[model samples]
Target: MDGLLLRTNYSDITEFILVGFSRRPHVQAAFFSGLLCLYLVTFLGNSLIVIVIQRDPQLHTPMYFFLSNLSFLDICYSTSWEPYVLTQCFKNFPTISYTRCYALMTTSLFLGMTECLLLAVMAYDRFVAISNPLRYTVIMNNQVCLQMAVGTWVSAFFISIVPIVAIPANFCGHNIINHFTCEIQAMLKLVCSDTSMSLILGLVISTFTLPLPFTFILISYIRIVAAVLRIRSTEARLKAFSTCGSHLTVVTIFYGTAIYMYVKPQSKESQDQDKVISIFYGAVTPMLNPLIYTLRNKDVKGALRKLIGGKEKS
Candidate 1:
């Protein structure tokens, strides 16, 4: 098995041919058209959220501060792959250079891991707001919010860099990545060397970065639920649920697709399924995020209406 795996020369592997899917022109064309629209919606929608948050003083709370950061991350997250995917749709064989592949992998991982931590932080913010309403402002002030944002980005960047340094160097053979993007799992599959260390490190990282944050979110929600239940007024309960619900939905969509893509055992069928899921998380979710937040949150809706009405009147 070891001999069979060590079958390619790493020195010759300058670029990777991303044989994304079947070569049906119609399929590619359809994919291109659909994904292009989603990309536009994602870019514009998230940009709108950021703009609204910045322009509307009403949205200057800790929640919206975190939300604006999330919007920015969504923009970066989608662009890291959407443009490449769009370009690949027209080509007969989409290829990525070694350096570019590493870049894509790093950027995607950094943004994604950062989101995991950000969502957890947002959940903690909600806990503070709902459970300790009196001191919420003091607890989640500008300094704390800024530190959390900076911490998420810095930690995720360093965590993502581990693979960039190790994987390329250890990819002793094979240059063909069997996906549209240089996803860590797909790239890992192409390595023709002993991947035990890489695999172990990846597993360790995933455990800490994925499950730990998810646990925090889960625990936060549990306490939030307890607090919400204590509220006597129906309207108050609904309002409280609404705030947590939107974040929960977004978190579910993101973490669900991500966990499915990364945590599962790789198989031919699963790999094909993962391509569709990649499109969902990479494009669809980002487009839906702003809609979810704006549609569900009255302040955001009102602010948007105010912003639009003011422009129209002028």
Candidate 2:
């Protein structure tokens, strides 16, 4: 019996308890309701953009192609953890299996990183359109767009896998994750071994994936602005800014929340605040992206109307 107890104690844990949201029943109910709405909206909105982009011949340009990719990424990024978050809001300290936990973490990381690079690519596409309008078609040709899109996905997946595969789930300490989802940082808090390597790895990865991409976007926009300013017509500049404004807003919100969540120093108070900020990054941002793009872009709004009008005519 003593030997059996010792074996159990020494065994690697296979599950983790997710301490999600508030324990108050009222808060849980409100959270569940709000998150469910956001999930449904995100799924519907992003799916609509994907369908519209696929069906609308006018949106076949490289810009729309990248926008479609971003929409799809938002869908995937939200799906990686939102459902689990919804489940956790209703249930107290729900447990997720180690395998599933890591799977969610890996998927979230993959999508997040892919999005960072994809945004940069989109910014580059805009720069090409603005700075070299004469060769925009040649530069952002179908082949180039396809290559960039594939590279973004492949690169992000490999980068995400590096740390995930290196960090084994052989945790020998507390298995309680303080976040709504199986976040890498929250999961790291449970590791009994020295997590310095993992922490350093995360920091290095963040440097490359987060701020680097943001800087690239800023540079691209700067160049684009310079080119736009050279245009003599006031209407032309307004049109140019309007075209890229939605994307810029999205980049700001996404990177702002992500930088705060990952790049900021961790503390007890920040940990508590992390859950709230995470909702913006994980749930609200995805839900808002489709709306931001569709509402701001007349082309998308027209396509949506055409789609709905066609259905009605049928």
Candidate 3:
């Protein structure tokens, strides 16, 4: 049995090649082009958010602070995925070593988890604004917002370390990850050893990382909705709901895709399907965020008008 097991091992299997859909040269070329464009747009959109938020002191509220961080994270998130795939177009086989794999996985997990925390924080900001407009500034002051932001990154930092320490113990088999990036699910599937520990770690982290944050967001919005309903003024309630409505929509898409990817067991039928969902959370979500936020936001539009009007006046 030992000899049989050894027989299956090939010297060339040291690197796990990505079987990214469609080996056809045309399909691959199209994929590379498309991903490159998305990558560029992702950076530009997020960078503009950061720049505009920082430059426009009037927009220096908790909302824009969170938006700037979100944009920065989106930029980093895309970097964690796109650079590897795009490099493949130029190189014969864009290979990542074990050390690189571990690093990439850690970065992706860190940013992904951090975004989970940040989104929850943003939801709370919206919740506070709609529910208690009288005390918005005092409630979401610079010091308070700073703590929230710092706490988010720190939580993700320490939380990510747990997985990094855990993953190295598993005996890597075939060392190939199927997706564009070194995702946790992709890494776990290739391990030769028992996955019980990885699963347990995933469960533990996911509790802090997902459901609780989701629960908080849910509770906040539930209260928010209730408060909005009580307001006899139709115009005020409608205006409040409009802002919260956009946030709710964006949250549902972001969390819905994320929950689909990570919450369920990836059965054989769902594995390829999961890949598409991963693209939704990992790629599509970032691109959509700035568009959704800026276009939907009345303040941002007003600011843009002021910016353009000032330019025209000059």
Candidate 4:
């Protein structure tokens, strides 16, 4: 196994061919148009959220502070690879250089891991707000929120590096990736080296990044529900549930698709399904987040109205 794995020289490989979608011209044109629309919507929607949060004094609390960060993450997340994907859609043979491929992979993983941790932090914020309303501000103060945001980014950066380092460096000349971007599983399939160790490391890292944070969010929500239940006023209970509904929706869409994508075993048969799922979490979710939050939350709706009104007045 060792000899066979070592047979291929990785240095000889300079680029990877991304076998993204249907080669038919009509199919490619439709895919391109669709992705372009998704990218535009994601960018504008998340940007609006960030702008609204920054300009609104009422949204300066810990919850909105975290939301601003999330919006920024979504913007960066969508921007990082969507352009490349869009460009690749029309290409007869889409190719990404080795360095560029790795860079995109690492960046995507870092942003995604940041999102996972940030969502967990947001859950904790909701938990504190619902569970200890009196001390919510005191507990999740400006300094603490800043620290949590910084810590989430820094931790995700390092965590994203782990799997990249663990992956076998040698590749057998098979450089075709079946996905649009440099998705980890798709890239891993191209490696000629023995991948058992890499697979194990990827699983362990996936557990840390996915299940642990998801479990934390689940536990936090459970407590939040318990606290909400204890509230005597029916109206108050409704408000509490309303506050969390957007976050829960976002969490369910994001983590549900992500956990399914990363945690499950990947096979050739699933590559097409994987691409569609990736679009849901990657493109559609970001596009939908602002809509979900704004439409569902009164405060955000008010802020958006004020922002639009102010702009119109100006």
Candidate 5:
């Protein structure tokens, strides 16, 4: 059959050409500079949060524990691709080895999925804290928090790998990827075989990763808001809102862009749009997370100040 012949003759793609931003020198230069700066900020900000939380005994609570994990995830997530993307800016035709491409894709997917579940867990933490202040410690004990964290990472890995495993090795023969990184949807566009199964599998996995966790977050917030409203004191209500506002902002920025990117139909016309949106959740949100939490949180800020004072006194 002709199909058999086509399959037999298929070229084993050794590498993939990443067609990143505009080929213009000016555009590449600007984007490289902007992305480099963003990466640095993201690294430093998240790193600082982790270090501060680890050193501060006051911050050993369930909330900061989750935040530290989030920071670590952001560091790993961005590092998986940003350096490659930066180097590609200098090349006329940027290429990634086939094995490395898949590795990066799998890593990013696992981390992204972990973050989604982690965020939902964090929302649940907030709900427990605000709704049952007295029982919060008992409910979210060290063992429970550790189990949740472990479960999030483990579940995300399984979820991330399933769709990847489903994709036939020879599904894509094309060597050119039109996006910056080895994003699944972008790679899907290059498939030489029928993509219906791949797309369906991706949709099912994405539902569990994105929408399901997102819905849990929304429900958790609804309950949190209801609990806060029942508080009689204006000061208590303001305090509750203040504690949650940063997490809510982060969830919105991350999940909003993510939902848009993954949940929507991927089209040829939307590749550029996809890149732009990816930059938000991928780079911008990570950089902003530390700033948002620190600026809004008195406890984190106080701990930061105390750390600085201790260093200065030494």
Candidate 6:
């Protein structure tokens, strides 16, 4: 495929130029300020979560274990493009170097994959807790939790390397990415080589990564609902259901927008629509996750309490 599509020399494609959002002054400025604040919150929120989880031994459970990993992945996932996007607010045409593009690809791929896996693991944890409440403690032991977290990271890293190999070698003579980040789809579009494999590979990866996790999440919730209904205690059932509400909402938003953006082919109208969704997933989702999922969590609240007390005492 590489040899066949070599229209011109290969060495000319040295950088990937990103044509960011338009030159509208008010829009640019507004976006700049808004994204800057979000990025700051993302860094601070995730950092705080990790610190609290570490310092507060009470949070060393399976749920918080995955949640902390999720937060870390969200930070990496957002930073893969958010800072670059913020920086591009004033530039007439902000260009990301080829190496930077590759770096973004690698980081985004790994982080995105990690987030997906984390969601899956979280689903399993929910399933175990809800479906087998009596044995949840035994099932979600420290060793098992560590294995799940480590396994998720390793799987994501392994799968992400394929694109790094393919993209750099086949990007023959053009390197213009339309979005702020080095997107997998946008980068694939720039490649001069046969994209059949890339497209297929993308479809395959997206299928394996998203649908199964979502299915497990759906199953976990369905079982949770059944368990809740069987409960004679109304208040207990409602309280039990509340535990999954935030996570389910997050899963819906993340997977729904992601599928709409990439799984289905985009018309020109849809492409314009997709840019907004992409921004949501890449930037907005990370910002929302901490606020919605962790901040609202009672255990996290307790950890924060402990942290504040420790600081005041010292």
What overall lDDT goes with each candidate model? 0.80, 0.81, 0.72, 0.83, 0.82, 0.72
Model 4, 179-244: lDDT tens digits are: 888887677667766677766667778888888999999999999999999999999999899989
Give Cα distance to truth, residue 261, candidate 4, Å.
1.1
Residue lDDT tens for model 5, 78-156 = 8988988898887876888877887887787788888888999999999999999999999999999999999999988
Please count the clashing residue pairs in each candidate, in the order shown. Answer: 0, 0, 1, 0, 0, 0
TM-score of predicted model 4?
0.93
For model 2, what is the alpha-carbon lDDT of residue 138? 95
Model 1 per-residue lDDT tens digits across residues 1-314: 00011123447676788867645566887888898999898899999999999999989999999999999999999999889888877777678887788778778878888888898999999999999999999999999999999999998887877555645334554676767787767676776566666566676787777777888899999999999999999998999999999999988888788777766655423266667887776778888899899999988988888878753223
State the lDDT at 105 in candidate 4.
Answer: 81
lDDT of 4: 0.83
**If both were scored by TM-score, which would come out higher, candidate 4 or candidate 6?**
4
Between candidates 1 and 3, which one is better according to TM-score?
1
- Residues forming the 10-long window of minimal summed lDDT in candidate 3: 1-10
* lDDT string, candidate 3, 170-259, tens digits: 433566566656676766666565556666667777777777888899999999999899889998888788777766776777778887
Assess every candidate by TM-score: 0.92, 0.92, 0.87, 0.93, 0.93, 0.89
As for lDDT, the candidate ahead, 5 or 6, is 5
Model 4: lowest-lDDT 10 consecutive positions: 1-10
lDDT of 5 at 290: 90
Over 137-215, each residue of candidate 6 has an lDDT whose tens digit, in order, gives 8999989999999999998777777544643336656666666666766666666666665566667777777777778
Off by over 4 Å in 4: 1-10, 268-270, 310-314
